[model samples]
Target: MFRSNSTTDCVQHITTSVELTPIRNYISELNLVHHSKRVFKLKLNFPKFIVICNNNGARLLELQSKVEENWIDLQCRVRGYGIGVWLGLTDLQREGQYVTMSDACRPRYSNWMRGEPNNGNGNEHCAMYWITRSGWNDTVCKGKINFVSTFKDAMIFCNNLGAELLELQSKAEENWVDLQCRIRGYSYGVWLGLSDVRTEGQFVSLSDARKPRGNFRNWAKGEPSNGGNSEHCVIYWTTRIGWNDARCTDKFNVACKKQKEIAYD
Candidate 1:
């Protein structure tokens, strides 16, 4: 059973290396550093810099959407620095198979410069923000560059623990989970494994890619409106009986599930 005295606990199994303060605003503070010439001269490689970010309770930034790009541009304007910055994207695992360092998931959105990501010299595996071109460019991982940082999300945290968001397949299972939460005094909403991320209006289980059995739906009244056209993820809105569509990025309680072990006779 999962238990947390805190106001938020994405999942019981997923524990963070560093304590993170609960976000009070939709957008947490973005840390985009444009270090001094002396620091830039250090020429630290990608691996070394990633360690620094982790040690400081941060991660190499991942630009998942244009909103983040615009956010970076806004920061650049305020700071008056437009040099390239290191992004958390890389094809180190496999050529042309870029994945974000924050979650090892393929970026849902990318802004590659025209003819960019050419994997120049066969060594350009890391990605960087091309401020001049207003897009991304693959570059050498050994190159010295500035970087950005942001906190990780619940899904990533759960994945790190070898579990996935909870998926309710039957009314009995849903009732059991709800009962457990009530018994544990958990009152906040919790993230579920259901989502329509791949196709609008087509919900599926993240664990098995299956639809709800019997087409069971417990959506709250007038729910799943996909408010702002961004609510693709589903969550238990304060209780098990009521579900709501929400932004995948939004922070909420998480309930993860792991398959039970089966023993051969």
Candidate 2:
């Protein structure tokens, strides 16, 4: 039995004419990786098994056969290690291939042949080994491969997707606020961004010049201090009205502006 002290340490096994059925059985006993509810699938079929780290599905298609020659690893500093491993396995399975999934944190190999330790550390958070009917064959698989270079790269990909979703939600909220302001006929002054200073006994607009651009401006009541000529102004939400100095850098719910209709005789 091949045992590893740490999941990151590499284990090399040489099987002696073992059948595929037993190999599959041994792999089943090991732990399976988990991923997010959403997944991206890939289609790459090979008789040999593959080992990958950190569950990077997006870059799966870019994998090349050359990676098989030397041990490949990826290191991503993301919070979700399980999700990353699950995604990589999911992509492999989608390609009609059952993969041996293991983590750099916990690795367990079944009884098999052995050699000198081929341990390594690199961009690979996960590693994949191509398995064949010959039983854990070691021939370089052929394909184009893409590798992750840094933690920032992985973060940028995830963050950009999140930002896009938020932008869409904000647009919808603005539309709702606009409808509310128009129906009120300017009678209800839409306090788009107002706050009260609880300690200073005053209500102030978030747009106060004295306030920094990073304050939380919920306008809770008696905020803004109003220490220096800081009366809240009725700035059009569509124009500069929505922003106050209090919550300059802080993200807040956006309000819409409605113009008063002029009556012509």
Q: Using lDDT as the measure, which candidate wins?
A: 1
Deviation from native of the Cα of residue 245 in model 2, angstroms: 18
Residue-level lDDT of model 1, residues 172-223, one tens digit each, is 7667666544433334456787889899988887767788656777888889
Tell me the RMSD of model 1 versus the true structure: 19.7
Model 2 alpha-carbon miss at residue 71, Å: 19
Clashing pairs in 1: 10-254
Q: Show model 1 residue runs off by greater than 4 Å.
A: 1-54, 57-152, 261-265
Each candidate's clash count: 1, 44
C-alpha lDDT values of all predictions: 0.60, 0.24
Alpha-carbon runs more than 4 Å astray in model 2: 1-78, 82-108, 111-265
Task: Find the candidate with the highest TM-score and give its number.
Answer: 1
